[model samples]
Target: MTLPHVHIIGTGLLGTSLGLALRRAEYPVTLSDQSPTAVRLAADMGAGTAAEPSTADIVVVATPPDVAARTIVAALDTWPEATVTDVASVKTAVLAEARTLTGDPVLARYIGCHPMAGREKSGAIAARDDLFLARPWVVCSDEDTPADRLAAVVALAEATGAAVVHLDPEFHDSAVARVSHAPQVLASLMAGRLKDMPADGVALAGQGLRDVTRIAASDPGLWTQILAGNAAEVRAVLADVRADLDALIGALDLEPGALATIAGLFAAGNEGHDRIPGKHGQAPARYSSVTVFIDDTPGALARLFTDVGELGVNVEDIRIDHATGIKLGSVDISVIPSAQVTLTEGLAARGWWVPEAAIDTEGRE
Candidate 1:
């Protein structure tokens, strides 16, 4: 089969990653960006040739949400027969604007897509070919879209090792508002609270703080475009969050029924968290956590993983928490209940520190 040549516009993270993945998949890829240096960097990283394809079979608009519609329209006009798709996180607004800019015939050649994969970091420097692996690549196609065009876009998405999900533009926007967009807003807000804190106060942070604020270091200009583009849906989700925040504040004021309200909120949060899918989009499964203290040095993590691997225990998850006052890191290894005992015992026998609670005991878990 002749692999379709994919011409990617915008040599940022997504575009470069897609180019790398397509090139790895034996699909001819051409890359371009407004910044010459950016496209050159992507090309240097073996993503694609730093040039435009004369005849593109597929044109990917991997620009920001604000400019994505214009880019999509331009791609449709540039390559009349090429299937054009955008990887903008927001779908509805981009699709709406693209439809407004061009006629139905040209617009039918364009499809709005969102690859539910990205790191907090941006740019080609952070691009990874395997970034889309195991991530959901949402395709917002309508009845009016051509079958061949849809297939081409889907094939492009699959080439990046992403699982394709078909969703309408409106639903994709609302769904992302709840899952991704709102969470980013919340993380930024919570991280901002630390800006005014004293050095000592900030130094006392733990793993929980790190987890919440990890993405807070993202590029403000890029996120501004995303949040602005999906204002309505994001605002709706934030308004609901605001109501919950108001309730929490009221409870903190020691009003009547305050305890019940506080308890209900936490309980509801737990229930909601429990509903989240497990790895590979499977149903949630409970796991036991085993905490191990290690010296803050290189090879410590690798040694721990090697130990676990030697024990033949399957680890479900891992979290590292640096000790505040000491040069030590606490590693929390989560595994199924069945493997918890085996892992803990194996580590303990290997002279690794095992917390009393994590160790196998006849009386308790």
Candidate 2:
């Protein structure tokens, strides 16, 4: 099949990553950005050559949410024959603005898209060719969007190894506000509390704290644009979160039935967490975690994995917990419940330390 030549505007992380993915698949890719240095850096990093004054089969506007509509309209005007799409996180406002900025024909060729993939970091330097692998890429199409243009956008998404889902612009905006935007805001708020803490207090942090606040390291300028663009939807979700916070705070004051209310909140949180899909979009499955102690030295992890491979046991997930002030670490390997006994026996017989009491199906030691 003949692949479309992809012209990407805005050489930030998403745009550069798209260029690299397309180029890896042997599709012709051209890259351009308002920042001359960014475009040059992206090209040097094997994303694509600097875009020349030429036509393309598809134009991808991977700009921030604030400028997405303007960039999409401009791309449609510049590449009249190409299907234009934008990878902004928000959709409804961009689509609405694009409609006001251009006529029917131009609007017909433009599709709004959002790739549910990114790191906490930003810019071309952080772009990875496989950034979209196994990630959800939302294609938002209105009734006016041309069928062929929509298909072109889907094909582009697939080329980057993304699972494509079609959604209306309004629904896409609201859904992301709940899942993506709200979480970012919460993470930032939590991390903000650490700013005034003593160094000794911060030193006591662990994996749980790291996981919760990881996205707080994201680019604030970019997030400001994203949060602003989806303000209504984000605000709606935040209001619910705020109400829950108020309830918890009130409970802390020892109101009547306060303990029950707090316990109910915890229970609800656990249920919500379990509802999140696991690998391959499957329903969450219970896995048994096998904790193995290892020396903090090179090749220790490799040997463990090799032993697990030899035993024909697939490791679903792995977490390493390094003992503070000790030359030891614990490797927690998650496997199917049925394989727990066999894996434990196999590793123990191989002279590896497998604590008999550490094999738990509940994923805790």
Candidate 3:
């Protein structure tokens, strides 16, 4: 039997990412976008062929929330047999608009979905085949949804190696508003405040500032639409955060241990932080450090890895810290077990640079 053809509307990041994943899996795929250039770029990126929408077995509307409903409704109207799903961020408004577009209950092919995977970038240029890998994809299925259609959409998620999660539209919006939307707003707002800062002041930013505000580079035009569409839920979540901040501020003027109450609040936050799942749904892996001095040259680390591969000891993780205008850089290789003297000697014999002392791994292995 032949594989079903999947049609994707909008060849932006999410759409093109999904298309590339599906196409890589050898699934027949069709891509459409309002921008012919984007569609062509997606095609070149191995997403799929630029084809008409009527020839698909599944139609995924991967447009922004503002346009998803109309596109989904039109696709369903135009392709009756196709199972329709959307990758919109906001669900409630889109679902309501979609229902309004289709009067008959038979046109029940629409299933609202939001994939919790994206980056600080946009467009087909940033589309990666593995973008959805190990990500949570929320599928909002109502009672009217067809069994086969639900399965097909879930299969699409599985095809991209994503975890499928079922959620009610309202609950989905509220949850995302708390975790995702709020963070985006905070990051962007914080970064915006630094606009007038001196170049030297901004240049003094360290990794902490980079980590916190990395997401601020996201497309403002797209995010403005998303934040506006789900303003109610976003504001609701932000209100609680505002209240917490207000309380913390009030505690600041208190004498010495008079701020114990504020510290207690942070203790609660620490517990919440610990509750988050570790990597790969398992306990977090511990690391032991092996620091090496690298010369400031391209492919130096690659040559070091080639030598390390000869030793047959796997490096679990690695970090490189380069010194400004210095001839040498430090690369810290993290292994599962502590780097033994024998391992160090073997690496040094192969002309690899081993530091006199290794960095501590916080008692981890």
Candidate 4:
């Protein structure tokens, strides 16, 4: 198949990454941005060349939520022959705006899309060609949207190695409000509590706290725009979360049945957490961890990995716990339940200290 000539506007992370991914797939890609420096940087990074007057087969508007509708309309106007799509997180507002801005003919060529992939960092510099690999790319379409235009949008997502999912614009907006927007708000809120803490209290931070606050470091300006654009849906999700928060607070007051409410809340959290798919969209598999003591010297991890590779044991995940005031650390290697015995025996035979009962057969600790 002859790949589409893709024209990407907005040289931020998603735009630049899309350009690079399309270019890597042997498609002709052209990039443009309101910021000349951004376009230049993305072009220099091999994302794509500077935009020129040419017929684009597909026009991708990767602008922020606030400007997505306008950019999509402008792209459709400029490239009348091309199928247009936007990578805006919020879709309902943009789709509604596009419906009002253009007649049925022009609107038929446009599809609203949101690629569920990103980093805490922003800008063209942080863009990666493989950003969309194995990620969910939601495509919002309507009755007025043409079949070929929808196919073109799906092709763009699939060409970049994303898994495409079809959704209505309203559902797309509501779904992201629950999954993406709510998480960002919660992460930021949790991180904010640490702002006034003592240094010692902050120093005690562990992996759990780090995991919770990681997305909190994202660009506030971008999030502010997203939250504002999806205010209605996001507010709905936040209201529910606030109610849960109130319940938890009330539980802490030790009123009658409060303890049971707290327990129910925790149980609900576990159930929800377990529902999240494991690696590669598969059912969550339980992995067993095998902890081994290793020196803190260089090549220690490499040696362990090499040994495991030789044993044909695939490590699912790993964590290192540095021993305080010591040169040795504990390495916890998580593997599928079936590999637990083989890995434990092999490491012990290789003269590695495998502590008895070191395998955490129960789910993640």
Candidate 5:
């Protein structure tokens, strides 16, 4: 069977990545971009041919949020028979703008989607064919949407190995505002503080700071467009954050009830953190950690995991922290609470050096 021809616009990270993934799925794909260099780069990277298509079965607008709406309108007009979709992070405003720009019934062909997958890097150079693997891809379709058109977009999203989720456009915008845009602003703000720090202070940074500031490395030009497009929604989330910040500051200065305020804030954070889904979108469940000391050598980590697997305890998650100024690392292996004691004892019996405190899994239970 002949797969649908999917023509991608913009040829940046998402666009190129989709083109690459679709091509791998045996779909006919053509790519174009405002920058000829970008399209050529994407093609050279095996994404697709850099050319304009007379028509396509589907047209994806992977341009930045600022240009996404007009681009969607253009795609609809250019390919009246094609199903169109945009992967812009902001949805409500983009859909509204497209609705305003076109009076043609082709407007119904335009579907807004946000693939909740990206990296800190940008451009075709950083594009990966598996970028969307197992990531959430939000499809904003309503009762007014045509069944075939929506199905085409969903198929396209699933073709890239993404998990498709249906959501209302307004709700999609509001949700991303709190989860994505606001966090980008906060990361950028926190990262900005490190710029003027003393060299020694900067050198002291560890994985914790890296986790918080990682997205701060994303494109400023693109983020400015995203934050501006979702200003009202982002502002709402930020306002709540500011309120919490002000309350904390006031408590510190006012002295009375200071400790209670701090404790309450931390407790609120813990409650919120637990709401985040675990691996494979499962409900969050408390897992017990078994930290093991391992030599910082190539096969050392693999050997430890092999030993753990032999012990028959499923590994839920893992983290490794290098011991400062030493050629040793501590690997924290998270497993179901029930398996904690067996895994700890099993590893120690195998000479894996399980920490004495970690061996007492009852405390964590």
Candidate 6:
């Protein structure tokens, strides 16, 4: 029996990553791009077949917003044997364009998709097979969409270790406008303010600024297309933010204890922030730190955790910086606040070096 072939169009980060994931799972893969270099590189990186997409069972259009709709339309029109999907950020416009381009004939064979995962990186070279792991991959289907198409897309997403979410295309755009696009614009705007400041000014920058503006480093060419495609929804969110900023400025001007009134606004923000899921859908949990030196050997991490468990301390978080081909590892374990001292001493006495046991006191850590 022939293995199912999955074709990925536009072998950029998302496309190549998906291809890498599908290929790793033993599915047959084919990769294509207008750039021969991109196609060659992604294929060399074990992403796909490096052949035309006409013979695949799945076709994923992962191009930029400008061409994503037409790309999807072309896939549906050209590859009726394949279940069609896209990884474009803005779904509403692409879906609308696909509707106009293909009419009702191929709608059921096409599913609108967006994987809510990315890094401040681009191109096939930056693609990682596990990039979509544990991230939300949304599938939007209209009433006319076929169950098999939706299931195929969901299966692809699940094979990449992503959780599948279903939503209407319109709501998906609006929701992302609030959580994704608005943040991108806001980050760009904030980072833009740093241009005139002294170079040393950024040297003094803390993780807070980095956290808020990290997405500012995204590709401007790609973002221009996305913001343009989802202009209405993005503008709506920005408008609401503008109104809040104006109110906040007005509140600052109030005399004396007038500042106290706006405290509720901030407190509300804090509460709402806590309600959002943390890493792996867990609630927001804070941790105290215990820094340890790890031997660069197999099961070193396992031993560290075992030692920590012996101290009756639960590790709430952990980070490891083990450079490739290096013989030493720096591991920071985050435990309950009250257990930091006990765990630190226990690990140190067990011949593990403990440096800073205090909470990092900064950064998202």
**In model 2, which runs have C-alpha deviations exceeding 4 angstroms?**
357-365
Task: List residue ranges in candidate 1 displaced over 4 A.
Answer: 297-303, 325-327, 358-365
The lDDT of model 4 is: 0.88
Q: Give the C-alpha miss distance for residue 315 in model 5, angstroms.
A: 2.0
CA lDDT scores, all candidates in order: 0.88, 0.88, 0.84, 0.88, 0.88, 0.84
Put the candidates in TM-score order, highest first.
4, 2, 5, 1, 3, 6
Clashes of each: 0, 0, 0, 0, 0, 0
Error of 6 at 218 (Å): 2.4
Evaluate candidate 1 by giving its C-alpha RMSD to the native, one decimal.
3.0
Alpha-carbon RMSD, each predicted model: 3.0, 1.9, 3.6, 1.8, 2.3, 5.1
Give per-residue CA lDDT, model 6, range 1-365, as digits (tens): 44467888999999999999988888888888999999999999999878884466888899887899888888887887788889998989988888888777777888889899887788999999999998999998877777776777788899999999999889999998988888889999999999999988777786578779878888898788888989999999999888878878878888777677588678777776766665557666656777788888899888888888788887777777765577998887877677878988888899898996656443235
User: lDDT tens string, model 5, 335-354?
Assistant: 98889889888998998888
Give the Å shift of residue 17 in candidate 4. Answer: 1.4
**TM-score-superior candidate, 3 or 6:** 3
Q: Tens digits of per-residue lDDT for model 2 on 275-347?
A: 7776648877678888899999999999999999999999888899999999999998889888888899999
Q: What is the per-residue lDDT of model 4 for residues 30-94, given as tens digits with 9 covering 90 to 100?
A: 98999999999999999999976469988889988888888889888988898888899988888
In the predicted model 3, the residue pairs found to clash are none
lDDT of 1 by residue, 1-365 (tens): 89988899999999999989999999988999999999999999999998877789889998877899999999888888899888999988887788789899888788889999998788999999999998999998889888988998899899889999999989988998998888888999999999999998998787678888888888888889888989999999999999999999989988789999999999998788877777748777677788899999999989989999999998887878787678999888878778888888899999999896343332111
